[model samples]
Target: MSLTLYALGVAVLLSASFFYLFGYRSWRRRRVMAKPFPADWQTILDRDVWVYRHLPEPLQARLRPLIQVFLDEKRFYGCAGLTVTDTMRVTIAAEACLLILNLPLSFYDDLRAILVYPSAYRVPDIHREGEVLSESSGVHLGDSWQRGKVILSWEDVVAGAGHHQHGHNVAIHEFTHQLDQADGSADGAPMLRSSNALRTWSQVFSKAFDNLQKTLEQGHSELIDPYGATNPAEFFAVVTETFFERPRALHREHPALYRQLQQFFDLDPLSWTRAGD
Candidate 1:
């Protein structure tokens, strides 16, 4: 054989070895993560997360693996002198995974880290003045970035988890933003299963948003929080919070909008309501 041919064969062997090792390591890591769900974590979810308790037992079983994989894939950091705990991790993961419980799990794959603050934290707001940008800071309960980071106030997370029917869950709200960002733009639209689905969603959401705006202007009480009327992206996130947190109210007040969310999420939270009763 020619020297060049021998060298080529050796290179192919090395490449195969490298790939095999990498794949093996990944399989081993996932095997470890697949271990039975921890009892302490179950205790945390039971004690802290009201929504989890409302879920049917089979759905709870399905959600457990999603939570485990979520905890395995994402990293958490404590900011503002807060010490992160297992309870915090499990609580956050459970709430966040609740959004994608019925959808494919790939939606959150781009998300890499979650930064938790002890309370509402200040983030600088940048205003572009043509030639320069001005900065001012304001306190925020939570924020999601397109670059794979989510910031949350630990206090608000705890409150939101406990108060399941208040139409306010920071974890669910921010994670929905992550879902919106999955398609490379936070434009209140995630990648739907089909173009037809997108059209239906667009028509329903646009009409709902307009009606919501009109209702807010008329100073009438709305089932969805007024904060959702801010923008399409915020509207999606805000309504997502209400969908999971207060499903019955959403279904009753905005049946069309609630159906759109149900189709997109592929889960009927209203059934959970009936189950709870």
Candidate 2:
């Protein structure tokens, strides 16, 4: 062969090999991500994921793959001498996935790990206002951090999952905070699509939050948790719990706020029958 022909043949061979290797790696990565759903995890989901069982068949079908992805990606740590089991992981993943089921989600990209306790956990109740700091002991069911960690009590998780009628789910509450903190702050708002959407969100959220505070100040019971009046961040989390757990009440009491949440979440819980249905 001529020297030029030999050189060109070598170049073509190298190019073909490079493309083949790249394609193989891409296929391999996809296969790894598309791992088969585990039978034990499915059993756990069937038994412990109460909210999931209540979802419509279509929604459940849609959510199962996402739950699989979430389980595959995130890490779970047992705290307070608790041993994290497939049940714990599935239960937590199911509730957390419910929030993002109808929305575009990267599977809570900011969160790296979930820390669970066997029961209520204690933390330093440190209050920092400017330069002043006061420390005390406080008990919590669950808490989420901006630095990619969520702490939960497994007892609370089970209770919240099993009792959707109570409008209290520690898993839902804390994970909502994770979504709120996705944009670097747990300031009540999550990542929205546009400036206009943000403005609408601010107006609707601020008005409802103020009304909740007013109702609390008047010493009358409110439909949503009064703890929501704590701050905009907590208000968002607290109302989220109510929105999913007690959608009918939220809609009847705070129609505008419920509509806003419905728009943001892209789901209508009221349309579907509850667990018994």
Model 1, span 51-137: residue lDDT tens: 899899988987888899888889999998889999899999999999888887778878999999999999899889899989999
Best of the candidates, TM-score: 1
Lowest summed-lDDT stretch of 10 residues in model 1? 24-33
How close to the true structure is residue 261 of candidate 2, measured as C-alpha lDDT?
85
TM, every model: 0.89, 0.86
Task: State each model's C-alpha RMSD to the native.
Answer: 3.2, 5.9
Report the number of backbone clashes for model 1: 0
